[model samples]
Target: MQTAQRKSLTMLRWMMVASLALPVALFLIAGYVSYGTTYEEADREIRRSLDVVHEHALKVFETIDRSLSEIDEIVRDLTDADIKAREQVLHARLRQLSDALPQLKSAWVFDAHGRPLVNSMLYPAPDMSFLDRDYFDAHVKESVGTFIGATLTPRSPYQGAAFFSISRRRQSDDGSFTGIIQTSVLPDYFEHFYARIGRAPGSYFALRRFDGLVLARFPVTERSAGPAPHDIPAMAADTDRLVTETSPLDAIERRVGYQRLAGYPVYVSAGLDTATIRNRWLGTMSRHLIFGIPATVLLIIFLTLARRRTEHFYVEAARRLEAEDALKHGQRMEALGQLTGGVAHDFNNLLTVIRASADLLRRPNLPDERRQRYIDAISDTVARASKLTSQLLAFARRQTLKPEVFDIGRSVVALRDMTKTLVGSRIEVVTSVPPEPCYVNADAGQFETALINMAVNARDAMAGQGLLSIAVAPASDLPTPVAPHHRPPLGYVAIAVQDTGIGIPQDQFSRIFEPFFTTKTIGHGTGLGLSQVFGFAKQSGGEIGVTSEVGRGATFTLYLPRVAPSHEPRSEAAGHAAPIGGRGMSVLVVEDNIDVGRSATEALAELGYLTTLVDNARDALEELVGGASRFDVVFTDVVMPGMTGLELAEEIRRLDLNIPVVLASGYSHVLAQQGTNGFELLRKPYSIEELSRVLHKVAPVPHHRAPPVAPNSEVR
Candidate 1:
């Protein structure tokens, strides 16, 4: 019995030891993986910083080259006598050029013997000689196309400021060096630019010649503008793209990128302090250690206690889980309620417009002008309601899209007036579109709706006062994928809406697209606007993205797949014309709703068409097949209780009936599921003019000389 008890105690001790060692091993592995990830991210950030610096440096150099070229052209045209005669005019021109370019400290013309012929500042030309200047020496010996020389302080008139000369050699028609046109650029100009771009304390950028002579450096020290150290690393010499080493000037480790400026012998380099990189990594690691150590310790303690009171812990955990599930259910219910309430509110407003317009139209003594106004008001309200329904369908991912290839840039330009009206007068609307068209294949209506939605969102963000800009351009790179399985295509056309407003908070990024998620006060917004835009972009084979800084602004970009130029779709304006009158045309109307069927039948009859109405497709088919009724056209709704209108149309084709069919619907999942088979589709709440036009398109009737028939008699 004593042996058995001792063995049991030993096993228990081993089990406890195993439990403690497991968490430590796992945590250490996790820490290693996390640290490696952070290091790689830091390296990538360094490369990005280098690219930005390189671009800025290239711009500065280009400006210098252009200034020198202009000076060379002006000097080459003038003879020595012309320069002496027109000296004042020449000086005025140089001063103008200098004033235009803040980077240019001064401009001067030098003779082959290195004497200043004309200076940009002051008349009578202050006597100056560039005999010892490298730029002048190079030009005098041989024609130097363009050369940047060492830093020098000017003499007398231009004293007290350090300037580097960028010189262009001027030649006569005989191909002999005439003179050098030189422009002095202030090093402080570049220093300020570098300072703006470099955010970190120790981070710096430098411009150096091919031979390692430093021209400019940020955090300017006396040694920085001098020659580079003899022990300069190979990365800073020649055309080495990027390297990580200890900087010779500051004796600090840095990761640097260097590039030779295009058309110039000098190189530009940007470096980030290795100490800053390491400090960032250390801070991240410290945070993990701070939370992770205690969490691990607590986990171990909990596991030990859980093993002893397993049943009790399980009961408590089950209760907590139940409570969490209940909370989640409540949250879901709230979201659903919000969505429904928003939809209802918008629909109610639309109904108010329609109801008020109809009530005003019923007034007996209304003038012809007032009558027309009420009629137009009702028509506009119906169109608005249709748009609302379309947006709701888009949010539900069931909108029946009529995709066509069109120029996106042109389309956005066309919306400028409408966008201005939507956002109102307080906000300024600006548009930037390329002169060349960028074509994309998408539903034009939905695309326009998306733009309108974005503009409204921007207006709201600005609180009714700000600048709203809409820009369309071809994207160089694919947009970031919004979903894990989404693989972006090779190219896209981006429509971006930018605003100066109170920007979005970082924490709301993930929830911005949720159906009912919003930051606006209740009754101020519905929050389905962005959701519709998101769904439309995805369903149209594209993606949307947003970038915002807390106090700066926000830009929302919609990326649509680009289409070939040859496939430019026809515009809607081209399809509309004066409505043609129907003269005793026969028609078959099939609709499921009683009120809709009655109204349609009466309207067609009033328009001089003999009409027959049925509630379902089967009845309409029976009437067509069995009755002695001759029909010129068949008009039907897309969705119904039995045998959908699309199917009915298909059957008519199968039966070889020589009749045209027009399908109409408010919102049809069927139209989205099974596309319309070449049948003309008229969206619901269509105007009488639209109805007449579509009928004339499918089946035409000549004018009748007989008197107008009564509506009740015309309906059969």
Candidate 2:
């Protein structure tokens, strides 16, 4: 083990050394590659600049050549007899050509004797003897095509300034040379044109003849326009269009591009200073090194630290995973505890009332009025317990829903009395609703319960003495309040409940909607109130929001999706007499719990229904299939042993039995999960009045005396 450990340590040290050395090797390779690329880019840019300058220079030379050709045509047509007559015409044309071209210095016609016949600059004509000019001598000897003269200081009309001439041989109709028609261009013309090309300060552009005599140079001086030095390389090399050369005039190193102008003996060259290119490349390389060095150093430091902390990292990661598991488990347990405690507390209260009432009735001396009162109290307490369970189911999103489109404004107005009662006389209740009805699709009872919950919360916050206001409006008319991780509805009908009370704090906002998360002291609140409201909003495809500032007031708004108005009014079952009895109609009670089954059967019997109780869905199915007894309605619990009530209902349907099925459940996911399959559902802990109403609606006996009320009627 000790030998293995030594070898492992040596291997790790080698690996670390290799890791550090690899980046350095890569850095050196990258630097070399980058330098090559930078050099190529700089060379490309210089060539591109040279191309632009060459194009401009080409245009200048072509213009000059075209003007010379035009002059030759005019001179070719001139005859001795018509020379005096055409002199004025010829001079005017030459002056027009010179004026049109900024580069042309002067235009003139010379006779075979080398004497100027007409000059464009001197109006009437000057006594210019051009026989001494090199261009004049060339035209007199071998005057055939055009000839570009070397740069020289010309006398007379040119003002003794250095200029070059492009001369074309003028021939008579017999093809005999008459004289040369020449145009002179000063070096300043090229200087001004080159300046516009916008090269670097040290850069240069030059026009030179085929024999290496420079005709024009940008930043021109007397010294720049001269013969090329013997030491300079040949400018017209076929393979060397681009080259690096030191200027004879300034001794500055430059990258030069050369191109010979077409139809002329002159060549144009554009150069870029090599020093400038080198400086730019160095700047870029320096920047890369400046940033890369520190980054490489930091990487080495990080690797060293990472090796040192490897064990610690593993330990911390394991600890984090354990902590996360514990936190999630704690959350699940807390939620479960809150739900169980709330349900237990409510059911225990109802049991206490029922137990007390039964004990009172057991007394032999109990008065008839007192006995009836105790029974009534027991029934009312059971009804309250049923309502509490319904609210809890709704909060859990498991309750069966009967959604309808109704006017939200009218619903708020209908709840005015109820809101007043909930807040009590100490708090003033106010309501504001638009005259125009706003419609929404939702379970009306659940919506009312949510609204009442909001009002009650508001009342508690106000200490039951502040003002409580309920308003109904279109969602478009209200400013939507922001909530963390909640999406606002597009189109909705907003119902806002506002109160003048001690507002909720910012720290408790996220937890306000959690189950059993109440700000009130224990026994004063169940904390499921807001939870119910929150669940109702989400299940209805909407959202809920709250806005509160401490010491000011609080407002809770419920936004429900808006629906198009329907012409038909919603028919409600309230304000009608409920059916009192089942009229001896038979019901099949299928429950897994023996006590629940017996109690349900007894309740149905009390409602004038003959109920046959069964312990499970299988027993109930056996009786129905054997035809031992026929039931008017198949009233069965949703969850049962052997087979489920939903499956039993389906079997009854397959049997073609005309009996209606009513399902009941204390709390089951069947209604929320698999759906109701069109069967009516009655929540557990139902009252006798509710059972009677359901029985009469499903199967009413002809002999019954009481008239049937709406199935949805409540004993509010």
Candidate 3:
């Protein structure tokens, strides 16, 4: 009776198992099948949408081409006219064309001398001197067709709107050259067209020169003042073909579609809102879950009773695997941090060398133009160093900021040129700056560095085969400069660096800005990028926020305070010569770094000052104390091994009370003391001019006279 009962129970269990398994197995298979079909259909829809988008883009290009062609024909007619009668005909034609083409702000004709033949204004006889603009010079060499200038809003003659010039060469019927025809297009016309092309929010449409200068944009902001993308590699590879790519801009996924103008090499790009499309899919997916989850749960419950042992084993195994993965991740992160730190240190040293060497190259002996070139080189090198330092600081949390009011649009335009060095030849950078000035008060240098680093991080994430987009604009509805609780209005310049690379893992987003945290392989990332951005934003009295996803991309924003209403950014003189002494005097120079010390001494000596060199601050004090016939000035390094230069300066004051002292340091804080006769400070790696000024201020030696310096033009 017991054996019979056990057999009956076993049979019942088997039947229960089959009953549960059949429904779940069937449902799972059916669910997978449905998913496969849905995925295929969705993909097809996306492709179809993309095709439609492409076709619309082609039409837009064709329209622009047609408009340009019409302008070209007009230019030819104006050029063929006789020079003597050019002014009258040009005036009549310009007026007619301006009336005919409402898109035009004005039209004019310019002779070889850049003299305006006819102006489109009511009072057409304005001074021709102003007519000799860049457009005229650009058209002077045009063999055929027209050249379009970057958009500009003429504040005078026309007001309250932006405009860009298109210049076409004029040739006579006999092939002789006459004047050139020019037309200025109002921005609103193109802006309307741009708005229509991809009306989806977060989409980007822009016109850029082959060199990456932004010509026009649909949505604009203050950050647009910075650099945009136009690297040689991407553009070089592009011919007259339409290319589609992907990137992240503003923390949103985007698809870029571009075509070079058929005749002109100008590049026009449109960015599709990937998130919008993905969101549409997500909504669909969410709907499936609403229905599918209950079905799945019911099936699981039915199966669970019969296959409880199998379920237990599967769950336990998954938990163990997750633990193992966590352990491996921790080990990997620790290794990456160490590697990133070491690399940053070495890179910093190299940057220091490059910066210092560039400074050295900018000597007074060079020609004014060459000196300017070297100065530019030095500027470029400093910018590069600043970028590297930002990366290190972002990684290490040590960046300092010096804020100023600036146009973000200008800055981004400039940065586009620099992206090449950071990302190399593989990545292309694109930018869109609004016509409205993006005014913000922040550390311009640091802000720029933040943008560049973000770009580099994006590039690295992309593995050098993607597009990096930067967009600058005023933050909408951001607080004004003085809202105590709200961050002061930075005019809210938003710098967004986006990339179409492998994106951040959802679980790792918060850690991205943490010191030494990374999602990269063991040696790939030190994970300081977002952190430095965070630190930089906080230091500049700004904020940083990010949005990212796995397998998509990321966008980082840095918001800084806008310049105060009453405050305007001061225009700095390109270079200042340190004022030399009115009377010659002997200066005692003390520094431990031989190279720095020697350079200082030599530069001082070159300025006609007698210099005494010592190895440290103590020797400097002794030299001053050892004589009643003391040196006129003491220039000493602030930091040394034993006694700091500050302590030594104090000792010298106790002995030779009247001797003037100027403290120098690589770090600025050590030279903080002021108000005493011995209280002047100078920064190291200073130029000869800087040293001369320090001496003149501290020790006014009676016989000292400044060396005759030529004007800036004569510096070389």
Candidate 4:
């Protein structure tokens, strides 16, 4: 569980990190894309406006050229003296052309002498020297197609607004420069048209000569600026281009698109201020951040809260588990204390009896009858000690068992008379058995002992006056709490011992199964009866439960898995078998304890058997397999250091030795779980009669009796 909790917490932490990290990553990507998109849109819009200006400027230049060409054609064959003579007619035609075109301020004709011949405003034009003007001198010096001059404020006729002159050179038929046809073009004409093209604040529009000079501008600023803040691109080429530079008029940075009028020596430019472009980008990002940051923050907050809550949950769970462990530890300690005290008290009582009997027997010249009685008393005390130890082993669930299938209903019914006599004639013993047999597989002796224990406990509860009911019936299964996890829910036979006596209390319910816990006052009950019942039920793949109420009868139910009816255990003969003489047959005794080995060999000799003894299984095997004296049977202890008696038996079986192997053990975990593996078993603390019987059952019968080699025995 702790590992799983760690994994869960680690997952939550990673999610919290991602909750913040992922959105930031997405926002950075979005910002980069939107930044590019904003500038590109401004560039596209600026280029479009410049395209409109380009087309319009081209038409204006072409129209003025056409007008100059027509005037030139009219005076092509006329001489200068002839042109002056017809000045009134030529002036009227010029005035007519000027009045028709709104962009033209006036038109004039100048002679090759750098003198104006006639003008559209005045019939006989003012005698002004044209050589001083770049427009007039440029045609006289070079053979140019058309000359677009720098910006100027015209003399007096239309001098308020700035306009530049568009002039065409007049050539005679011999290709000599005669004069220039000059026209004053209105800059307001282009400015007003450009003003109509929509632009945001700090934007600009302009028409410039091909020589990088500003000719006309919208929202015109004073030309008082210092050096340009950044470099200007060479937009004088025939192709259009985009440039980012400071505006010369305002010293503000702007992105400009320059388009040259097709087939003309003029260019039109449109600009959008960088600040305005950035504002547009900021607006888009502002909208995104307005939603994105809050959402990301909320997600982060949610993850943080989840992390905190998960930490709290695990902390509380750990504390609860710790508390539970402490509780179980305290309970086990309490049970151990009770078990130690009870075991000491019981053993001390048995020892006192044995000591007293031995002391009585040590008197001088004791009577034969009294001596016999003392010896019997000592033997009985020893038996009691052995039984106490057996109960302890049973409570620990380590005692060996001989399990067989038997009808449980008949078994309990047969115990009715004995229970009545034991519980006493005062307490009524009742038996309830189902008509159909309920069979179970368990140790018959333990089952009988458990029943009797419960019966005796009921007698004590009632103080020998209440009814004791013993019932056997078919039980399907036990409660979920009563069943162990490793055991499956199988068909069961339930034996219930109900007593109408002082009932068990609820507070003592859990301790009832603990070793040496009894309700009867101390010195009145030994307190191992119910514990034996608990251990027996568990070892036999079953469960035991109790239900009781104060002042009401209590019921202890033992649930054992039911089995198919089998052959019942037949009664054995009362007489013991005559001791077989083992004069010819030899026995191999394998015991780990030195005292046990000596005692076993001596006992075999008393039983008229020749014996060989060894402390461990290895030497026993050598004696049986390769020793000079061949043995007819093998006896070995089950638990030893290197090789267990069971393993030694199996090895002998593999050797295919015809000798029988008898296994002996007091308590072994292997024996409790897996059983004897089909070998004759002598339980620990066995007497000579029991050992002799087991050996007789497994070993060959000896026919010849011989005098045994013993220092104290008399030969017959």
Residues 72-97, model 3: lDDT tens digits = 56555444234335555646665776
Better of 3 and 4 by lDDT: 4
Between candidates 1 and 4, name the one with more favorable TM-score. 1
Scored by CA lDDT, what does every candidate get?
0.78, 0.75, 0.62, 0.79
Order of the predicted models by lDDT, top scorer first: 4, 1, 2, 3
Give per-residue CA lDDT, model 4, range 17-58, as digits (tens). 888787788789899999999999999989888777887788
> Candidate 3: worst 10 consecutive residues by lDDT?
707-716
* Ranking of predictions according to TM-score: 1, 4, 2, 3
Worst 10 residues of 4 by lDDT: 224-233
* lDDT of candidate 1 over 1-716, digit per residue (tens): 98998887786666567556755675677667877776677567656766777777777778778877787777777886688678899899999999898788889887776777787877767666767887877787677677888777766666646878888887788878777889898888878888887777557687777776667886676643344333243334455445777756768787677777777887777777777767776787778778877865665567656345646876899999999999999999997888788778888988898899899989899999989898878777777777777777887778878888888988898899999999999999999998878888788888998999899999999989999999998885555544432344537888999999999998999988877678988788778889989989988878899999877779999989887765443756323355555677777788888677778777777777777777899988887787423777888998899799999999999988777899998778768766687898988877767887888888886332323324343323
Candidate 2 vs candidate 4: the lDDT winner is 4
Q: Judging by lDDT against the true structure, name the best candidate.
A: 4
Q: What is the TM-score of each candidate against the true structure?
A: 0.53, 0.51, 0.38, 0.52
Compose the digit string of candidate 2's lDDT tens values, residues 606-637: 66666677777777777777763456777888
- Model 4 spans with C-alpha error above 4 angstroms: 1-333, 481-490, 568-584, 627-629, 703-716
